[model samples]
Target: MIKLTERQDKILQIVKQNGPITGQEIAVKLSLTRAALRPDLAILTMSGKLDARPRVGYFFNENYEVKRQAEKFLHQQVIDYKAHPIVVDKSTAVYDAIVQLFLEDVGTLYAVDSRGHLAGVVSRKDLLRATLGNKNLHELPVSVIMTRMPNIFTIRPDATLLEAAKKMIDNHIDSLPVVKEVEEQRNTYFLLGRITKTTITRAYLEIMER
Candidate 1:
């Protein structure tokens, strides 16, 4: 959606109320000349706020309102809204990882190498699967069961929130690691933060409230 000027917003409100209204009538309501409204009218139409007809006047496009709301978060960058990441060392025992997961109240955990670089991702299901038929979870390391790099789905700090949401939905996952690439290092990235389904939900709610 285009950035709406103050006058364009007024024009939109006017068309919404009285459309199929002509430009001349809109100008009359605003106490302005038709010539003066020409620019604003053209901007509104071009921005998809209003639709025009041959003889009838400009009509507000109601569907565009839905798109306008959607645009609120689509272009929002991830760096501004990521949450603190829950991290565990790759060598951390499965039992400890499970305890950390419960303590943090998160569905997934990021496993980082000693350099604070992301190595793998651990989920609740992964931990649970590792516990099956194994009474000695303390002896098992999370690295043994975690989804390692090259198989992990990660988002960059510069990515859009919409991209993050789409990734979660498409992968049927709950969260993603927000990473910053390590310079001069291949297949390595520093764990920066996390983005979750809850995060996106909160963002949408905030946008709606505003």
Candidate 2:
């Protein structure tokens, strides 16, 4: 946790926006001597807040800051950060799924079976693809095109936000279905909620400021 002074923040901002600008130009803009700025530059670079190249001067390393903060926030769990999921039954029609998707404004929907186990997953794209050349939207079952269990990718509520984010990225999926195992029933998983890239990003921004 490195905290920047007002002067350092200003310098970093200048370098970040007008980076590769000469040290002399930065000093002039900030009304400081090259000598005074050198120490601040050294501290910034040493703290991994800035990257200085010989001919390129100074540039803010966005990836460095993101990585550092991600490490700090990696312990956050999906259960604490996940949003309420939009769910539909496996027998739901494509027409109804479209209505639900629009009503909820969600990109993905979880399909559960009668036993309260995850049955499949359907995306807005799946419904759209199913409806493309057909006039039988009402007759089509979501299960017909949904990604079935054992094939559906899921994340536990206890999983770290970073882990959930990585899973979403790796699977090329927009959202992750968060599940909780029930002790009463064997092989039964309940849909706890959902975690999306948007959810993680918003949470990261909100908490990182603290």
Candidate 3:
């Protein structure tokens, strides 16, 4: 939350790119006297944005800034980064589901009921396990193995990125089904999109680059 002056900002950027750098070297880069740059360096160090040592010189406080940025980015809504849902009908055969899984190249697939409402979640492991001893992949319904509603962990479009990330981590899942609860029905959730680990990684990279 610290507001840095333009010169201080430039100094921070310089230190970030090329540190541990000497004050003398930084001064030369800025074409400013060492004396002129002292105050800015002191302010940045005291504010915990930079770290200094007698022999090591100055370095950008990478951890603190990255942590702060992560905290800020976590509050961003999931809807902003949610990707289109790759879904299958609840009755879709396990073999067909496996085909869609490979064709879409996604780890998880949302299964919808005949009404097109989210009914269950199918994962690669589920399909693989199903195929282990079972010979009839053609007769197997994905719904039989899919994790059903109420047991599935889901996120709303309005939920924070942090919420989605935490849910995935806590549940040891690679993705979350983004859903909208129906007004009249309590158990039904309309699938909106998916929030995956890939989605979170992309969002983090976008924030870092900015």
Candidate 4:
């Protein structure tokens, strides 16, 4: 959804109150020139907040309430929903990674390099697959099987939860590693936290409860 500016919001309210009203009329109410309100009117129309007919004037979109509520949900940022990340060293044994998964009851774990920068991602399924035909789990480093950098999908702390959810759904993953870039030259990032499908569900539930 398009985020509305303060002036745009005011324009929406004006149209709601006196819809099918002309732009010139709206400008009069706000003590502004018709030219000043023209841009706002155009924005509102394009955002689907207002509908316009050449001579009939602007009418507040019939679906305004639903769209506004949707905007609320989609704009909820990932930073607000981030949870502590379960991290393990890239050199950690496959057996140890398996233990961490069950002990924490998390679906995925982040693998960090020696500097504590994100290196890879290991999932419960990956650990299970490693155990199927392997006998030396302890001797096998998770790095051998973990999804490596440049291949891993990650979310930034400031990204929207909607983006996080979409990425998870598109990739068939349940969670994302929330990272903050510390070294742009090397493109290395420190794991700040994580976001999961459960987190998105919980947030929606909380919104509904309110």
Number of colliding residue pairs in each model: 0, 0, 0, 0
Every model's TM-score: 0.72, 0.63, 0.66, 0.67
Tens-digit lDDT string for candidate 3 (1-210): 778999999999999999999999999999999999999999999988999999889999988877777777867899988999999999999999999999999999999988889999999999999999566999899999999998999999999998899899999999999999988999799999999999989887888697
**Candidate 3 residue runs with Cα over 4 Å from true position:** 1-72
lDDT of 4 at 183: 62
Q: Model 1, range 1-210, lDDT digits (tens) per residue?
A: 478888888988898988999998999988999999998888888888789998998988988878877776677989998999999999999999999999999999999989888999999999889999576889888899999997888999999998999999999889999998899987899999999999999988888787
Span of 10 residues, lowest total lDDT, candidate 4: 181-190
Writing each residue's lDDT as its tens digit, candidate 2 over 1-210 gives 777899999998998899877788899999889998988888998989888888768888889867876676877888898899888889988899999999999999899998767888898888878988676989888989898877877899889988998898888888888988777865567898999989978976877686
Candidates 1 and 4 compared by TM-score, better number: 1
Worst 10 residues of 1 by lDDT: 66-75
Put the candidates in TM-score order, highest first. Answer: 1, 4, 3, 2
* Residue-level lDDT for 204 in candidate 1: 81
- 76-194 in candidate 4: lDDT tens per residue? 89989999999999999999889889999999999999988899999888888899965699999999989999788899988999899899999998999998888654568888999
By lDDT, rank the candidates, best first.
3, 1, 4, 2
lDDT of 1 at 20: 94
Candidate with maximal lDDT: 3
Runs in model 1 with CA error above 4 Å?
A: 1-13, 73-81, 129-141, 158-174, 197-210
Which candidate, 1 or 4, would have the higher lDDT against the true structure?
1
